[model samples]
Structure formats: C-alpha cells, structure tokens
Target: MLLLEKGIGGKSLLDIVKVVHLTKRIIPLFWGAFLSIFILFLPGRVWAIQNSYKVGIEDVLSITVWGEPELDKTVVVAQDGTINYPLLGNIAVAGYTVKEIDELITRLLAADYLVNPQVDVMVKEYRSQKVLVLGEVLHPGLYILTGPTSLLEIISRAGGVSDKVGNQVSILRSPVEERKIKDNEHASTSVEEKEAKSILIDLEELLKGRDLAKNIYLEPGDIVFLAGKKDTNISEQQVYISGRVQKPGAYEYQKGLTALNACIMAGGFDK
Candidate 1:
C-alpha cells in the first residue's frame, strides 16, 4: 500500500509540473493576441482623441511600442511636465504635442535600445486642461476640458446657458509669449509682455446655428461671461446733434443708430 501511494503521488506531481509549463507557454500568446486587438482598434478610434491637443502636466498617457509589449505603459505627466520612461528616466513631454513626443521616444529607443521601433502615443485622460464658466450658467464653475471643445459644448457642460443669459458672450483670455529668448538676449523687464484680450461672441447667432463661425474654441484660463438683463455700464456716452437741426441737443449714444436717426432723436433736422 505504501509503495502504491508513493507512485500515485509522484504521478500527480508530474502532472502539476506539466500544467504549470503549459500555462507559462500560453500566457505570452494570450497577451500577444490581446495586444493585437488593442492595436487594431486603436486606429479606428483615433478620431476620438484629437491629435492637435498638446500634452500637459497631470495628463494620463498610454505609450506602446509594437513588437515589444513589455515597453507599453500608462503614465501620468508629473508636475515638472515630464514622464519617467523605462531606461530613459524623466523626459519632458508636457507642453509638447503627442506627435512630437512619439518622434522623441522613437528616436531615443532606436538610439539606445531597439532598432526601428514602432511607437504609438495616446492620452488616456486629460486631467490638465480646464476652462472657467461663469455668469448665467446653471452650473457656473470650472470645467475640465478633454478634447476639442467649442463654445456651445462648454455651455452645455455648464448645464446650458440660464434664461437670464443675454445674446452676447464675452471671453477673456491671457496672451502667451510667442518666442523663446536666450539668456543673453533676455531683457530685464519688470512687467511681462502678456496682455489681456477679450473676445465678443454673438450667442444668438451661434445657438441658432445660423453662423458656425461664431463658435470658438475655448483655451485654458478662458473666462466665459454671459451678459444678463442688467443694463450695460456706459461711461458718459453723449452724441451731439448740432448742425442745421431744430432744437439740437445731446442724445444717449446707442449702437446701430444711423446719423438720420441721431438727428431725429435730437428733435429732427430743420427744414
């Protein structure tokens, strides 16, 4: 009986070893098949991720290298605007477009580790970009922007414009520096050259879909102000209708009023 039990135990141990070996061989094949499907569907869904978006801090990224699945990783851009790549340490990826980062990674890998590596970059999450929506929006606050968002899309995200919102909307933007200067060329100016700019959009035309050009893309830090029913602040605007007019006097200046209308408002032109 002891001999039979020992023989049976040895056979079971051999079977267990065979099963573990089979699992080891099948795991890589399963992983490869899964990755093949992911790569196949990636191009089809490429339109969902705008290629025009620039990378930013805290944005999650999925980077993959074909034929080398071990290099694929999902990483978040650090506050220093960089990502830690395998064997490359920290590489600055933020403030750069994904295409640029792809080219960079491809070049680095080819130079250091691989030969003619095919790389793909995709943003898994856009946690960096944001826009502030205020004034007359049902949910007036900050909104996290994910893709190519138009003015109308942002309005909708804020629960659409409130009933009190007027036909005009104002977008306040901050100017960014266009060029980089070397240390020797840099000037010691107390004030930055960036200036505040305001864009006026005709919301009435935009919402009606009559003029799509009125729809504008929102940038980071852009403030959307919806004009309400309150009167616009006018700083002493008086139009004088004096020449050849009966009872000529000063009138309140209003937009779209022609010269004839102005004269009529000042008691009409003398006959």
Candidate 2:
C-alpha cells in the first residue's frame, strides 16, 4: 500500500494501471512490425543458405545451358570429384563450390567456345556426406548425414542399439577424419603425427539412462559399429558339455553340432 501510494511521479494506483495497460498494447504492435520485417527477409535467408552448400563427390548435379539443349545435361560427380561436360572434359567439381564451378564453366566456354554460355548448376542429390553404421543395431548400414548428427541420434536412426549396451559402440574415424583435420589445419600436423582417431560410446549410459555427454557429433565417413547383445553372443558362442560326459568342461562350438558330436569332442560320453 505504501509503495502504491508512492508510485512513479506521485501517480495513483489507477494511473499506474492505465500506463501498464497502454504499454501492454504498444508492445504487441512493435512485435508485429518486427515480425513482419523478419518474414519479408526470410526468402533471402533461405537463398543464402542454399547458396552456401559446396559440391562434393558422388553428388548428382542438374546442370542446364539456356537455349542450348545439346550443352545441357545432368551429371554425377565422379569418384575424383569431377564432372564430364561437353566443352570441359573431366572438370574437377569436387571441393569447389557450386557457384564457383558455375562461373568457371561459364568463363571457360565463353573464352574458347560459346559466345555467351549460360550455365545453371543445381544439386539433385547430396551423397558426399554419409556415415557407415554397422553391428548390433536393427538397421545398420550407410546412413546419409544431412546435417550435424549426434551419436545418440544416429543410434536411434539405426533402430537403436541391439541390447542397451551389451557391447561397446565404437566409432572408427580413420583416414577420412584425419584428412579433413589436415586440410583445415593448414598442414600443421606432419604425416607421422597424424593418426586415425576413435571414439567408444556407452549406449547403456544413454539408452538405459541419462548420459547426454556420451552423445557426440559424428562426421562424414565415420564408421559407427555397435556390438551384438552380450547374452546372445555368450549363448551363440562356445557349447559346454559336462555332467556324465567323457571329457567334461567347455568345448568349441561348431554349427550343427549334436549332443553326440559334443560328447565326441569331450572324448566320448562316459559309459
């Protein structure tokens, strides 16, 4: 009551309430205007995002030349990150950005061949960024990594781990990771110092419980291997023949091994 009596500039409670009400109305107007401007600029933002994607190996490209159907053709990037075009034979398109390659083809054709070549390059399919997911997961194989994906997300993508964490889920980031690091490092690391890096993830910690830290981001070409269920592995493994057997104890497990064969391996069942 005392604070209300001593309101801003000796204003009464009623005056303060009216001012707050006015402020509430004005805030929505400002927000609406800001959102309108932001919405208007969204198309440009999307265009920029699309323009920033670089071309890579195995990516299908839809390239067309305006007014010249003969020169227009869709091509896939080769293993060496190159494309075979009419004028440019075996042009290296890998590593080079889409815009760069577009300008290059345009310039090359105009210089020696076409008077004014019009080139349009668009990625029909992106195949360069992918990872290999193998082992105990339900669906394990090559997974396309469209964006930043965590280990946990990948496990879910592979239908989760076989059995929580019976076996370790390891990521073998070999020459692929090493090559990228060397490329970004400006060759700071020598060949001798460069080594393949590996990461072992505990799926039990993640699936069975909360261990957010175990979720690490994966890179293209990384191999994520999840081991099979420990219980299944144990059972499907060695077959033991003991009680009343000639030679008891554990014995090697061979497919289609009957009880008699097991007894034979154990020096024949005891009479």
Candidate 3:
C-alpha cells in the first residue's frame, strides 16, 4: 500500500511540472499575438512624443551640423512657409516638427558627403507669436503670445476688459472653412469673410470661479475680444434718478431709492 501511495504522488508531481511548462509557452504566444494585432490597428502616422515649435513669420532659427560647419546657418522662415539653408537651399521647414527638420537636415548632409550627421536646431528669437485683441479691451492691438500662452493669458496681457463693458469675451478663430478655402482657391467666400469663425469665451464665468476648459491655447492670428453682456433686468422697472445723490443714475425702484436723495444730484431741490 505504501509503494502504491508513493507512485501516485510522483505521477502528480510530474503532471504539475508539465502543466506549468505548457502555461509558460502558451502565455508568450498569446501575448505576442495580442501585441501584433494592436500594432496592426495603430494609426499609420503615430506622432512621436514631441515638443512642437510655433513658427512665426520672420522667426529666426539657428541650425548647426557637427563636423560640417559649412552647412551651419541662421535662417528666417518666410511668410510663404519656406526657409533658406546653406546647402539644401530653400527647404520648407514651417509646420514641421523639430525632429522632422533634423531628419531632413541629416538627409541633406548625407547627400553632400557627410555620413551620420549630428544636427542641432534652435529658435534664437521668437518674433512670430502675435495674436490680435479686439472689442472692449482698453487697448486693442496685436499682442505677442510666448510659449504655452493661453486665451486668458493673452487677454490679461492686453490690459483687461473695458470698465463700461461686461465680461463676455469672444475668441475668434478662423473656422475649418478657412482651411478648406486655403485648399481650394476658388471657394466662394471672400478671404476677409472666410476668416470670421471664432470661439466665444466667458470671462465673467472665469472671474466667478468657473472651470477653465473654455480657455484654450491661443494660436497666431487669433482674435480675442470682450463684448458686453445683455442686462436681463427690465429698464422700465428702474427709476430714473438724477442729481446730488450718494449714488447717481437709475436705481431699482423696488429698493434703496428715495425722492430726497434723487434731489441731491439734481442740486438738492432749490431751497
């Protein structure tokens, strides 16, 4: 009986080892199949983790290639999205990520007898980050937005809202139609009219401690505006009080307005 029990235990141990080995092999195969399927379903142009630079018209960029000093040059991006390089000569670098520019420079250098070139690109000065502030701001003009600048930051830099107006502001961004218009030159909308789509931002809510999801990163050519909010109170219900009062002008007749105070602003009812 003891020999029979030992034989059963040994058989069980062998079965356990076989099951563990089978699981180890099957798990790796399952994981590989899942990873392959996921990769196959991913977007073709997977954007790398990158820091994008906003290229403005007339912004200067310094490019340096190690071991190839002849290709080093400081170039300004033109308004038409083109840059002049030493050897490449008028390569379009605007709207391209820095990594893309680096790869392009590497290819250019390799063509001209340099192997495995090391390229460095830097923005020496940013002159192209300007946005326009219109409407009820005390000063309305083109304001420069530096790195990571948002709509509220640009508006605050523009000297706040006018005292006479409420805090409803409109941030006008050219609509998607603008892109279509650029693509199709013969589109019906005029250039001036096509540039009219803008997103509205409420500064009053922002001031009132509202969530700031409405405030987004402001781009070049964006128009920030402060427009007046319509007063819902009935004008007819307000009492017109002029003269030497503690607070002059129209007051809500329901509370706080007396005939005696109204006379004060109007020179205190002639004795």
Candidate 4:
C-alpha cells in the first residue's frame, strides 16, 4: 500500500511538492531577468548624471595622482577659470567634468613627466556658481548652484515668494557678449557695451504648471526679482494732499480722483 498524504484543497502531498518545485525554478528566472534589466540601465543613468556637472570659477578642487605623492594637492579655481598644478603651471579646468580633468592631467603628465599616470579629481568646495535673488521673497539673498538649477528651485531655496508678491517675476541676465568674455573669448569686447536682458515670467502660469517653459534654468550671476503688487488696497495706497490743502496730510488714493477733487476732499485748498 502506497502512502499519500492529503493536502489543502484536496491536493495530495505529491501535487504540492510539484508546485513548490515549479516555483523554485520560476523565482530564479524572474530574479535573473530583473537583475539583467537593472544592470543594463542603472549604470548609464548614473554616469549621465555624474558627467553633467562641470567645474566653474572659484570652485576648489582636490586632485591626486597614483604613485606620485608630490602631484596630490588641493587647488582653488581662479577668477579666470584656471589652476596652478605641480609640473603643470596653469591649466584651464572650468567647464570640464572631473573625468575630463583627470584625462587632461594624465595626458599632460605622461607627455614628459610620468609613465602611465593615473589621475583623479574631485570638488572640495562649490563656491563658483551663484545667483542673486531679490525683492518680495521670503529670504532675499544669494544662493549657490550645485548643479543645473532652475528659477523656481532657487526661489524655493530662498524660502519661496512672499505673500505680497505680484503676478510676474523678472530675471536679469548677462548679455551674450559678456558671457563670451567670461569664457576667455572676445578679449576686446567690453561688458558695458551690451546691456543685460530682462526676462519676465508669469508667476501664475509657472506656479500652476500651466506653462513649464517659463520656468527657465538659472545661470551664474543671474538676478531674480519678484515684484510686489502695485495695485494694493486704498489703505496701503495714499495721495499727498498738502501745501494749499486744509488737511495738509496724506489722503487715501482713489481711482480717477482729479487734483480738483483731491483739493475739494481736503476742504477746498485751505479755504
């Protein structure tokens, strides 16, 4: 007589064993496929994010060379976007990725100083990229930009807009000629020759996500001004009725009020 234990749902022990065995095989396949996808996609996404950051002026950098103690040093990028390295007097590192800087230093060192040099670079202090936020903000001041930052992001960093803010915001940006001069180009061009341009954004549209294109990315040295409401209530708005008026004081301003009406309201110009 063969022994057959009954299991749940009127299934035999043999049937349950078969289901468990199938599950064991399927689980590995599922995990393997999931890991394959993760491995294939995750690295590229991470690399793209890392490569997007570029060095800028006033940024401090820590650089090292494998097997060369003398080549390791911390350098601050100058206003001109350059750094003085050992055996390499001055190198332009602004607008370059860490990996690019590594390759650049390695190639230069291998040219005459070292053989098969391995180099590494890291940002010690991010002081270069900055923007100024002013007018009608909770905290009006300067902010640092670590990466690609948008106008809305900076405003949030400054504690968001104040309650008295208006419906629009203005951005004053450096002209193209000035930007080119900063990049070590157009040596003869004067920054004063070109006027900075102003960009107005509808705050209502931006905050509501109605028009995302208006939420522009902020650049270094950009100034963001949140204007206050010009059309405030009568209490907040006043007109000076003085000199020849009986009530030689500030009176509440009313729309369409003429000089004669103002004088009449002030008791007919001092009687």
Those runs of model 3 whose alpha carbons end farther than 4 Å from true positions after fitting are 1-50, 175-195, 228-271
lDDT of 2: 0.54
Which tens-of-lDDT digit does each residue in 134-204 have in candidate 4?
55556666677776677777776766665566777877663322222232221211233244566788987
Candidate that scores best on lDDT: 4
TM-score of 3: 0.54
In model 2, state the lDDT of residue 125: 84
Q: In angstroms, how far off is 204's CA in candidate 1?
A: 1.2
lDDT of 3 by residue, 1-271 (tens): 0000001111110000010000111122333343344335545323421336545456678889987778788888775556877756666665555666677677777877687889987776666555556544445566654455666556556555544345566664532111111221112122232433546556656644484687678765554655533442223343343322234344443222222222343343221
TM-score, model 4 to reference = 0.60
- Give all candidates' CA lDDT scores: 0.58, 0.54, 0.48, 0.59
**Structure candidate 4, residue pairs in collision:** none
lDDT preference between candidates 1 and 3, better one: 1
For model 2 the TM-score comes to 0.50
Candidate 3 total steric clashes: 9
Q: How many steric overlaps are in each model, in order?
A: 0, 0, 9, 0
Q: C-alpha displacement of 6 in model 3, angstroms?
A: 96
Cα lDDT tens digits, model 1, 142-185, are 66766666787777676666555567787765343222212211
TM-score sort, best first? 4, 1, 3, 2
